[model samples]
Target: MTPQTQPAPAPSPTQATAGTRRGRRPSLGAVALYPATFLALLVVAWFAVTTTGLVQPYIIPSPVDTWKAFTDNPEYLWGHTLVTTGETLAGFVIAAVVGVLVAVLMVYSPTLEKTFYPLILFAQVIPKIAIAPLFVVWLGFGASPKVLVAVLMAFFPVVISGISGLRSVDPELLELTSTMGASRIKTFWKVRFPAALPELLSGLKVAATLAVTGAVVGEFVGANSGLGFVILQANGNIDTAMLFAALIIMSALGVLLFAIIQVAETLLIPWHASRRNRG
Candidate 1:
């Protein structure tokens, strides 16, 4: 009797690419190490360059100065942060609901798309920032204008992505479903809709991230509250430290909001691409 040997399987493209790309699955220590090292090097370089007087300290504050500023007026900064957070969240919710509805309508009626696509294209072309002042005049210096601006900023990508997702259903599968005497609604709900989901979710993620940026911009142009308002006030006061603090806060808020959307999308479409992502 002879013993047989089984050879090992080859590595997948993803596994090979993952090592080259993300590398080592990113443990918490590695996560802390990279940014800390980069920032440390950056700080050292900054200290050397500034101390040498190549760039004045007034022009670029030290990392220590920025840290001091962040801790100085934590209470005052917190209030403005809440305002910006509110605007970002409100606009994201509105955009999500409207984006999905518009996508659904567009999918159901090609004529609706023909009627509306040009309008959306035109709206997108007319830069939101340019008409931000007009929004103030029309909607006043309230949160409504800010929310509207954010919604406009986030809407287009979602619609386009959703439509593309809906249309991406496999033709053969659709034909098979149709031949099986499925109704248009039934086919779409059971087959096409599920098929389109991952793409739509991906688009939603993009839209969610953009919405935060738009909300901040809206507040910057017109409002007496929120981080944008805080930024304006800090600029006026020449309070560099507070301004830097507010900027950091605004960035953190954006990242947090984007993460929330990703979480929601994962929860909603748990059985889809995200599951494969976990695997």
Candidate 2:
């Protein structure tokens, strides 16, 4: 009878090293192939429909025509993009600061939590769009209103996540810290806060997306500048291509900001379970 044998072991060290190096090197052609294919398909489909006279030119501009619009007045769109991005970043920072502090306080002091928790929940249910006009009236057609609106929209997620994180300390860990004669503040800083980090980061990601929406809403209400204002102006004049371009830019900005946050989270919490899974 032939001798039974186990499967070969994973490659020895030198071969494994070579395999990893090949995999790690970024491939430009591979990255570009699929997106270019899809883009070509989209253009062909759009041209076919528009050229067939099935739709009016103004109702659905061809890809070539949209390109012309984008190239012709890029400066105008870029200026408004800057304004929207600035407001989003500002409001996001404020929300992060205040949300963390409030959540921490709530976690530590039941009285403080009970006092404002109901009011905070009530405020969250109020319609954001309805408050848009009020923000414009109170803060006027400036950056303040846009920033505040963004802050309001993004703050809740951070607060909600932070509370859950701060309070999720294991009872066993708490008892261990107590047996070691650690003070409450010391135990919190050394043990509790670190445990909560993964949840807080997940919440931050949600807040980042909402923050962009808030800035746009703020612009829609009364601003003379910004992506939202640009959309309104473009719609009034029926400049659909520019409107779409502005929206695309806003989407890119949001994605970039959120990506940065995710990268930071990965770096700061490498030992956390989610980060390990991501790796």
- The lDDT, on a scale of 0 to 1, for candidate 1 is 0.80
Any residue pairs clashing in model 1, and if so which? none
lDDT of each: 0.80, 0.85
lDDT of 2 by residue, 144-234 (tens): 9999989999899999999999888798999898899978889988998898888899888888988899999999888999999998998
**Which parts of model 2 are misplaced by more than 4 Å?**
1-53
Candidate 1, poorest ten consecutive residues by summed lDDT: 19-28
Alpha-carbon deviation at 105 in model 1, angstroms: 1.1
Query: What digit string (tens of lDDT, one per residue) describes model 1 on residues 93-149?
Result: 888789878988988898998999899889888888887888899999999888998
In angstroms, give how far residue 220 of model 1 lies from its true place. Answer: 2.1
RMSD each, Å: 6.0, 6.1
